[model samples]
Target chain A: MNIKKNFRVILPVGVLALAAVAWAGSPQILQPAGPGPSTASFTAINKVFTGDWQQYGQLFTSWQGGLFNRIFLLILTIVPVVFLLHYIIIGAKSFSHAGTPIKFFGILTRFLHWLAALSFSLLVITGLMVVFGKFIGGGPLVMSGRSVHLIAAIVFCLSAAGLFLIWLKDMLPMPHDILWLLIMGGYLSKKKKPVPAGKFNAGQKVWFWLATVGGGIMAWSGYTLYSFAAPVDQIRQMAILHNLLAAGLVAFFIIHLYMSLFAVKGAISSMLTGYKSREEVAIMHSRYKI
Target chain B: MARMKFLCDVERCIDCNGCVVACKEGNQVPVGINRRRVITIGEGKPGEKSISVACMHCSDAPCIAVCPVDAIYQREDGIVLVNKKTCIGCGYCFMACPFGAPQFPSGKVFGARGAMDKCTFCAGGPEKTFSDEEKQLYGQNRIAEGKVPLCAAMCATKALMAGDANVIADAYRKRVFARGSGANAWGWDRAYGKK
Candidate 1:
C-alpha cells in the first residue's frame, strides 16, 4: 500500500480514537435528593423561574411562537413539493448518454432548489427534536431547547414561501399531464401502454398534487402544536395530523429517491449539475421543441 | 446515599398558603411563579383538604428522558435541576411532566415565552454564593449554607415538616401516640374513610 494512502486513512482513525477516550471520561448521571423546598438552596431555582414567567407570560396566550414554528415547517414541506411538482409537471427525460448535460431553468431555479434542500434538512432535524421531547435534555434543558427548535422552524417557513412564489408557475398542469398519469399508472402495473412525450408525465403530476395538499396539512398542523395556543383537544388533534403528514412526505420521498437513483439512472445528474443530455431531452420531451 | 422524598400530612395542612409564602420568601423566588403552591382538593365543601405541591423529583423523570439538549440533570441527592446556560428554553419538559411543575416565564402573548421556568426546590440556580441578581431572581441561597427549607421551619401550626423522610415519619408517629386515643391519629382516615 502507498504510504500517502496509509497516512490519510490512519489520521482519521487516530482522531476518532482520541475523541472516544475524551467522551468516555465525561461526567455521568448523579441524581440528587428530591429537591423539596429547602431553607437554604432557594435562590438559584427562583432566579430561573422569574425570567421565564416574564418571558412566557400566560400559557398558550400568544401567537408569535406559533408563527415562528409554522414558518420553518412551511419551508420544509414546500421545497420538496416544488421539486416533486417540477419533476412531475415538467417532463422527465431518461439519459441516453451517460455524461450528457441537460438544461432546465438556468440559475434561478438552481438557487431556489438549494434553499429548499437546506430548509428541508433543518425541518427534519428540528422536527425530530420536538417529537422526541426532552429525552435529549433534562427538564430545564428541554424548557429552553424547545424555543430554539421552534425559531429555526419559523425561518424555514419563510424560505418555503419564497420557493413557492418562484416555482408555482412551471407546475401548472397541461393537457398531457393527465394522460401521462394514466400511462404511468399502466406502466407501474406492468401493462403495455404508450410512453408519454410532454413537458411532464402522469406520475410527476401526481407528485405535484401530493406536495400541494400534503405541504398545506403539515404547515397548518405543525403551527398549531408549536404555538400550543389552541384548546387542548384541538392541539392533540393537530399533533396527530402533523405526524401523519410527515409520514406521507417520507413515503413520497422514498419513491422519488428510487426513481432518481436506480429506476432511472442518470436522472440525478440534472439536479447535481443543473443540466441534461440532448438525446434524453429528445426522447423524453419530443413533443415540445427545445 | 438517601433516596429523599417529601410527604405532606394533608390533614395537618390549613390551606394558609404559608408553605407557598415561605418558599417565595426563603428562596427569593420571582413573583407570579410559586416554586411550591398550596392546592385545595375539595373547594367550598365539607370534605375539603389542601396539600403543598412541588416537584416530585421522580426516580425516572420523564423530563430527563425527553430533553434533546441534555440541560436537565439529577443531582446525587436525587434533586432534578436544569443547567440554565445549556438550556435552550424549549419547554419539552413542561409537556413531559405529569404534575405541570415545569413552567415558562413567557406566556402565550408577545414573545414572552422567551425561556422555560420551573421549580428548583429552593436550591436556587447554578450560580455561586448569592449575588444581588441571584437573591432577587431566585431567593435565599440557604442550600449552599446547609439548611432545611424555610417553609417547614416557618409552619405556624407545626404541621408541615421537612427533612429525611424516615426522620419526619418517626416524629409524626410519636405525635400520634402522644394524643392518647382522643383524636384520630391519621385524620384523613377518620373523617373520609368509612360510611
Candidate 2:
C-alpha cells in the first residue's frame, strides 16, 4: 500500500468528518433549556401563551423559513469547498492497481446501495430546490421538482429499508469503531496506516444508521405533510424536525461520497463492479479480511 | 393608493360562517378548500369568540419569502396574490401562513397536491382582468369591478371588514368605542358620558 499518497487525502477528509460531527450535534432541539424570561412582567405575558403552540407559531415559521434554510445553504456551500480544497492540496489517495482485485460487495448490496444512493442524491437536489423555492421564483419547474421529490423519497425510503436489513450485522457498534472515530479512521495522518475498523468503518456506519433510521423518520414526517392527518401545528413541528435531520443526513452523505469516490482510488468500483482494488481495500479497510 | 386589508372583529363574529358561504358562492372555491373560515375559540365557554380567518395579505409575507418560484406576490394596495400558473403546490406557503390559508386541490396522480389554491383578497391573478382564463383559474376578479370582497360585502353583521386599511381601522375603532372596550374608553367618556 502507498502510505505516502494515502495520508495526503486523509487530513482534510478527517477535518470535514469532524465538522459534520460538530454541526450535527449543534441543532437547538438537542440544546439544553436556557434561562428564559427572567423578568416577572415578561413571564406574566408568557403565561398566556405558555401552553399554546399558536403562541410560538411565528417563531416556528421564521425559524424554519429563515434560520434553518440558511444553515442548509451553509452546509451545501461549505462541505464542497472543504472537499475541493483537500483535493487541490493533499490530492486523492492513489492505490496500487497491479494486484488481483477482491470480490467485496455482491450484486444485492450494489443494487441496494445504488438504488438508495441515486434516489437519495435526487432527493437532496429536489429538496433544496423546494427549500429555495422563492429564490427560484416559483414556477412549473419547481412544481415538477416537488413531484420528483415525492417520487424520489418513496424510492429512497424503500431502498434504505432494504439496505438497513442487509447491512445490520456489519453496522452494529464494535469496540474498534470508538477508536476509529477518535482518530477519524486514521485519515488525518500522513501515513497509510490501516485504520482500526470492521468491514465497514465508523463513518460508513454513521451513514448507514442515519440513512436508515433518520430516513424513516423523515419519511413519516413527509407523510404527515402530505396526509395532513395531524393539525397544522403538528405538521409544522414535523417539518422542522424533517429539515433538521436532512441537514445531518446531507452532511454525512457528502463525506461518504467524497471518501468512496475520491478519498481512495477505485473505491467506487467496489459498489459498482462489486470488486475492489486489493491494495485500496487493504489500506482503507485494514481490518477486513479478503 | 388604498392599502387593501381584512379585519375580522372577533367580538361581533357569531360563528354563522356567512363569510365562508359568500366566499364559496362568489369565488367558486374548490371543494375541500376554504378561502375563508370561521374559527370559534372557546366554542362552548362563556368567553367564546368566533373569528373569520383567511389570507391577511401581509406586507412582509412569509409565503413570498419562502416560495421557490416567487409565485406569491403583493399588489401596491398591499393585497397579496399568487400566480396559479407559477405555483407548484409545494405547501411551504401553507406551512408559512399563520391562518393556514393556502389550499391544495388533490391531484390526479397518487393524490399528490395540485397547484396551490389560495384566498386572493377577491382580486384575480396575473392574467387579464375579467378574462375567461382568469375566471377559470382564480374564480373571480371582484377587485377589478371596484367592489368590496364578496365575503365582506355580504356579511350580515359586517363582522368581517375588507377594503382600505384606514376605513377598516376607523370602523374597528368605532366598534371598540361602542362596545366600551378601547383604551380608557375615552371616546365613550366624551360621547356617551362615562359609565
Which number leads on TM-score? Answer: 2
Q: For residues A1-290, write the lDDT of model 1, one tens digit per residue.
A: 46755574467558857854653322212122133222111222222222222323222222212432454456557756665765565434344575655566557666665565566555665555554443564344444444544564556566556655554444445577666665553334332333555544556545554554456557666666566665333443455456556655655655666566644558667766777676665655545455
Tens digits of lDDT, candidate 1, B74-178: 876666776665565555566455445666565443353544556565556665657775565456756567766677767777677665546766777777677
In order, the Cα lDDT scores of the candidates are 0.54, 0.75
Interface RMSD of each: 15.4, 10.7
Best by lDDT: 2
Model 2: per-residue Cα lDDT over A116-163, one tens digit each:
889999998888887787677767777788778889999998888888
Q: Give the local distance difference test score of model 2.
A: 0.75
